[model samples]
Target chain A: MIRFDNVTKRYAGGHEGVSEICLEVDAGELVFLTGHSGAGKTTLLKLLALIERPTRGQVLLNGRNVGRLPARAIPEHRRGLGMVFQDHKLLPDRTVFENVSLPLIIAGLGRREIARRVRAALDQVGLLSRESSRPDALSTGEQQRVGIARAVVGRPRLLIADEPTGNLDPDLSLEIMMLFRRLNGVGVTMLIATHDLALVQELGGRRVILEGGRVSGEQD
Target chain B: MRLWLTRHVQNCLAAMGRLVQRPAGSLLTIAVIGIALALPAGLNVLVRNGEVLAGGWESARDFSVYLKPGEELAQAATLAKSLSANSNVDDVEIISAEAALADFQQSGSFEGALTGLDNNPLPHTLVVRPRPEAPASELAELARELGKDTSVDQVRLDTEWVERLNAILEFVRRGIWLAAGLLAIAVVVIVGNTIRLDIENRRAEIEVAKLLGATDAFVRRPFLYTGFWYGLGGGLFALVVVLVGLAVLGGPVARLSALYGASFQLQGLAGSGALTVLGGGLVAGLVGAWFAVSQHLTAIQPKI
Candidate 1:
């Protein structure tokens, strides 16, 4: 579960990245966040990950105020959620398996279990056969799939994605959305930020739209 | 517990692999550290050998008490007997002026010049050997006490040169230690600069790791291990350099001491000394890595 109460983030030059946002997503819920390039979607997700603290108000994840979490506790708090970025964020030097196993490795999982879960997650993303291949060797779609596998390998309760299919073709984007659908059906909560309104409608999840760093509208 | 061990082991191996990947750069850094460490280590060996030479001289603490020019052999013999009765005086031998003159003429290279003197000008001398364990200060005190006697003109203790040699050796010992300390700081700076460069090179990887929930400790582990390996390699190389230096100088040093009628041999680093060298390397490496990581790691934030 995630909750935001009047959260605001302001940069040093007095530019408000996000301001006074009140929102919530319950357990096992799939939500879509839609906004333009500078609409502060990334900032909201960063707040959830505790990457940047809210300048005002509280961010609660699983009933814990993440905005007030101690600096030392940020990593532990982040470990409970999985994050995927638009750029795929996979270490180019490492193989698909290593990239996927990063989260599990961070959690200090045993080798056998990491291998098993990585295989299962890769299978779900349809990149299981590309485990030993480096990210540079994969297509844009395949690289995104590898990122997804990495996000889910640690079995985090919440999955957050910033433009998960930004670099993919329409067909690949649909395929990736279907993968998220399947994951949502299996009781994994997710918050996805995307500019593709058509895909957002097609996927048929609750949509929260942002405009100029504020929540403009929500559609059920 | 098992998980912690497994992660640390993997971190160490991964760190080693990184160093091996760039062998030339790593070896160059290690060589710099080794040369720095070897300077002091070599000096230490030299100081130890000097101590050995000085120790040999100190063991023979003998003094010569010369009688006044007009003093007779009977007075000198009587003083020798009295000195021999003292607890600190191990032995005393009376050498009359006639015997001293004859002995000097037999072996002295200036024998013809010395034989031209009108009369035997040498005074009766009492050779006093102090107790085996007597300190130099105590022997000087004895010599001073003998000089105050009515029959004695000059009291000479052989310990003066030995004392001066000891002082020089002590000064060298302190200099070596100071050099060692300064070089140790140099080692830390060298290792620190190397680690800082390493952290910069891996900046992207570290950001990604932190984004994926890796703690500062987890991200720090590999770099720290890298520093450790660098230090270890440098320490081993330093030992090799010092040993090789000793090997090259060993024969020459022995022969030089032999010319002085001493069978002195250079001693290499013992087991504990080697451990200390290695330990110093480890500490320097770890400290340098820690400083680099703490300074640079915090500046890099995952900009989501």
Candidate 2:
């Protein structure tokens, strides 16, 4: 479903963010990306999200080279993938329901379909009752749950969570991981980038660890 | 394209909702824009009103011919009748010297001065009212034509006042254009600066939207709509300001016109001028929004 061939990303001022990385993930596979801070884990996720272009080589998704794709085609490629952030990033002014319905709205879904899908997504995250509440009015955990609901609401084939549990306590982090596991059980491809070694060992999925902008180890 | 427009409109509405959620800030912005727009609009009203007053003043005077004192009354009367029948003249009133002397005697202030006269000192006069469609230069030519007659002493054209009034109107018109130009520039800068501030404040949200595959147009639409509302609301406020100003000063204007013996009407924004005021506001808003969007949208991206 995704592939990278000798992809290199360099920021200005001679800083090498990611270099000579080659990797692939099969369909419906759950993968954990573990790396220390500034080890290019975020860079890899950004490259896959089409937010940053690789300086060299190519990044491919669904058999099309995204790095070689025209800038205009980047959005179309991103629509197929779901992304969650360390910060919930919920629109503070919007109700939880509205935030969750964003992707479907962007997709031009009708009002009825959006309502139905959003309700289902909220139900899956146990946030159906809090749909009318704004993000600021909710607890941090609930807000993160709303973020999760929004990410999955569009039913994207691939879900990327970049440090999704970064700001949460251990119990809350495990709860979010359980939510991810629940999502993965339903055949949604999941890639989680985190530095939590204990959590990774507990989840026991395929792990790819990065060291110094390169993939240093992997274990099933 | 349809989908894009639909979403864009929704995003605009959303932005407006957020703006309204903070009423004080919205009001402040609207007031600023309104004041700027109203300056030009109010000046335009003054220019139009000046033109109307000048037009009325020009319409008052007619062609006057002073006849030679020795000319026979019968001959002078015949000439007046002929001139009255001409296609160019609407009316001709013959004022004989005797009648002119009597009109001077009727006023008690001049009665004693005129009582000592042996023969009527006033010259026989012919007053000519030109056709409504006659041009000013044509009327001057007509006056020159009347001056060549053997029985006529002098032909005084009523055109000098018209020329002077036209000069004043031209001055006011130029002033209006200058004021409008300056005000328009002010509006663009004000709106642009406001939108730029808004873009900076919402930089995070814009970055997130772009990262989610939203296009520049998509991200920019909300801000543009915000600017549009600013313009539209400001325009409406400006219209209100102009009308209120006219209403407050209406009595004074009427009094001033009455003092000058003119039944002048001060016109408010009507027809095309109203459209222009509204359009000006809208254009300012759109342009300001465009500047901010073009400047900020491309520079933001997800974390490096």
Cα lDDT, all candidates: 0.89, 0.84
Model 1 global lDDT (CA atoms, 0 to 1) = 0.89
**Whole-model lDDT for model 2 versus the true structure?**
0.84
Q: Write the per-residue lDDT of candidate 2 for residues B259-285, one digit (tens) a residue.
A: 988787778778788789999999988
Residue-level lDDT for B264 in candidate 1: 81
Tens-place lDDT digits, model 1, residues A1-220: 7999999999889999899999999999999999898899999999998888899999998898889888999888778888889998989999999999988888888999999999999999888889999999999988998988888887889999999988888999999888888988888899999999999888787999999999999998
Candidate 1 lDDT, B94-170, residue by residue in tens: 88899888898888886988878999989988888887666678778778888899889998877778778877988
Candidate 1: pairs in clash:
none
TM-score for all predictions?
Answer: 0.90, 0.87
TM-score of chain B of 1: 0.80
